[model samples]
Target: MFTNTDSLLPRDDVVKFFEDAKTLLELRQDNNVEFWQNMDATALEIWLREDHPDKADTLNSRICLSALRELLSRHLAKMRCAAEWVHRIFEVSISELKSHPDYFILFSELCDDHPELLRDAYIHYGLAQAVQTLMARWYLQPKAEPLAGAKRALPHTFVKASDNEALARLLSRRWTSGDRFYADRDLLRPVVGDACTERKVLIFTRLKESENDSLSLAFDRARTVIEQGPRTSRLTETFADGLLRLPLTSSAGYLEHVRSRVAVLYLFDDRALFVEYPWNRSGTGHQRLAHAYSIGDKALPVQGTDYPVEQYDEVDTLFGWQQVYVPELPEWAAKALAGPSVHVPTSVRANS
Candidate 1:
């Protein structure tokens, strides 16, 4: 239940223009340059304080004056301080401000004072719309329709909305890469066959003496994956490629113990394996030494694609490690592997 716009007093002409916004949707819309250029002192202050709190505050709390009393006491608690005042001036923590209308008023004042920060302030508020939607759904409140897609809402207009668009692009790209970052049901189910069965996958915690104990604890939470399909592969960091590279013999012992007992020792909290080419080595030797490379005899070395590691911790904690034995050679590699089971005989010296 919010007004689109609030009428300003005669002196505050800047606010009068905005008061034209009669609904929350109108208020939520981006403000443009023409709107600012037409502002009188009153309207200017309102925009400055909300849009640029620091600059407005510097010129005597003209913009945020109305809401300052309620927020000043809560300021420290509301928004944490940055190292430099200038940094705070540019970046408004819209989430903290949006919850309290008084804070929003102050934000409006800040925006009025420092027009340059307008783009940033709008973007902050725009992103907060997503968060607000979540909150509304959780609280069973009606969702607010965002004033999206008007010509005035251009990139040059409001900093906050501009920031929102930037974030949208960033997230879109990250989502595209998400599959490589974590374990997916589709991936494991096809290779290991349903993750639920006991023999197919076992989750073992590194912080334990007994694999049996780890499995017991995991079973309580892992009923779906285990019963329906792919088994959870959990192992100590020691069993993982990068961790194994750490110079510690004790690590190898721990890894061997886990590997010998379980079909796949889950590399707990470890990122997926990838390839690493040695700068000095050329041809097969260099290509063979990737993070995802196979060790010992596969009867023959197999080629595979390397997956990029993003925020490994996020994926690892959400979905435990997946252990798949040497991947079925990809189509291209399989065709090549079929031709040769033995190494080419070559007796040339190093200098030759």
Candidate 2:
């Protein structure tokens, strides 16, 4: 929830939001994609209007309901992670749309109108909404029954919800570019593997040998773009254009791999190379990039009127190399270097 007083949704009202989603998903067949697109949560706006006059009003609401809690479970099963949570941080904005076509097309369109759409804070919001849109598709799939789907109430945690305080430290870290020093060089070895070194960094993508090349190419292409950029006029813009033009498909798998590699290059490597599309909009993360290239202010690159991307209701996020560098890590890291023992969880996910 945000620090804004008027914006907070009480514990129970947040739960009601889920019940309403369940009820609405239960109510329709969704035979026409166009129809839902046109209506796009206006129906939901009315359904929950008394509670939240506008659907956006529901932003920052706590999703501590049993069903949502179940979705935040540490264990994943049947596209649901309903287990006891170690910690849950859900900052949702525009959680679901009335429509089901929330692929890259929808994202592009939204970015067209809302410049804030590309910020790091809202990145997961869009991702979560995409998941909801995908969930709608699953419920509306051929031979599937919305009636039963609503009853199942499979709460899907969106974005990077986590139980580990260690991750909160990193994800919450201020986004930046240019060369900066980290606190403990060894602490990042897990996330950066051997890459966190003065030697030319190599990406250890924690993927099976069979599936690695496909993702590795993504890194190679990104590197090619970064290497070719003109530092004077188009370094950030060239990289930005390349990011927009990259052959990287916006599939669930591709995004996972892209982000993993993005973190590696940005953190372990010296080049700003680039970060997410819109940059961090809050003017805090990578402000120089935003100031220099308007990275966070530009509309997303879209093809034609609509962009097609794989729609999914849930994203399986793991603690990657970036997870170890919490906001305070630099300070803590420096202290740990000079001092005695301090407990810091190393990456089990990174390749040994």
Candidate 3:
């Protein structure tokens, strides 16, 4: 069973992941918000990173709304004109041609127009992201620690156009480029960076995105907070989708990604809490609203939308985590393991 080995463990990363999850369960039992907040960081630094002492200067947000309206309107006109021009060439009309009129209509229409428009849409969405980002960043004073700015600042969403994979990946190429956290000069696990970033996507919506399925599911699952136990079944749907959407270039790469940024289902009775187990950050998804949820407690005093459905009992099961012991060994030879062989030892079997 111990075919593969890493310096950290006797078997391999696959086994090590579950062991770390078990540790998180224990931590959850013992502590409160502190444990989750500072999974790796020290107490003091987590404060600086999460709970900022100084608020940014008051934003002139009334202008931001007007600005967003003007900006979106301008872009919409551009897209509509482009759509009209292209469709007219083929003796067609974008408005006349019917779409399913579902959530992805925006994306679907963009795809029908031209591949270039898809590119523009992706850039267009990113530019819209930039608009909100710049507004927030404009007021932020330089941080004493530059990384703190990134770590402490609120999360932003990415837009997608599935046509150009190169362009799609370009946006995130440099994000996790470095591993070390500068605060108090701490070492960072580059693998954990993906987990950290994904966890911050608090404003999940079930808008039926044509972009990344994981983001859609993340928001979809987030809605479970509204009906705590009833949405338990969606876990299976989410897992199935994860399998379908895995960017599996190779078995080895997929396994490594799973091991490093492990998503664990902490079963605390009927309610299961999932940690860092959402969609690929680089996929096509409409990243809407920089601040989608109204600020509130675990009870979630949301004004209208039912996102951030309060706190959830994330622990997934009444019993400990289990594995069915994959019947076959991973073809990667050097990389699979079973805890203890079910059959008798070769010598014992022969003796029997």
TM-scores for every candidate against the unseen true structure: 0.17, 0.18, 0.19
lDDT-better candidate, 1 vs 2:
2
lDDT of 1 by residue, 259-309 (tens): 112123222222111111111111121222322223222322222323222
Estimate, for each residue in 1-352, the C-alpha lDDT of model 2 and write its tens digit: 2335754544555556656645543343232222223232433333344334465544433444333434222111211210000001111333342233442334455445444434532523234354334444543234533453222211111112143232234444443432223233345432333333221122221222223322222222221111111222111211221322321211112222111123322321111111222221111222222232331222332222122322121211121222121222346433333433333333223111
- Predictions ranked by lDDT, top down? 2, 3, 1
Best by TM-score: 3
Off by over 4 Å in 1: 1-87, 90-107, 119-352
Q: Tell me the spans in candidate 3 whose CA falls farther than 4 Å from its real position.
A: 1-58, 76-194, 199-236, 240-352
Off by over 4 Å in 2: 1-165, 172-185, 190-218, 222-241, 244-352
lDDT of 3 by residue, 1-352 (tens): 1223454233232233224333433332111122222132222122222322241111123443233334334443443344333334223433343222221224445456556545655544443332223222222224243343232211212323132232222222232211111111011111112223211211111122233432322221221122123332111112322221111111122222221122332111111122344332111110111121212122333445443232234534212211111112112211111122222111101100
Candidate 1 minimal-lDDT segment of 10 residues = 220-229
RMSD of each: 26.2, 22.6, 24.6
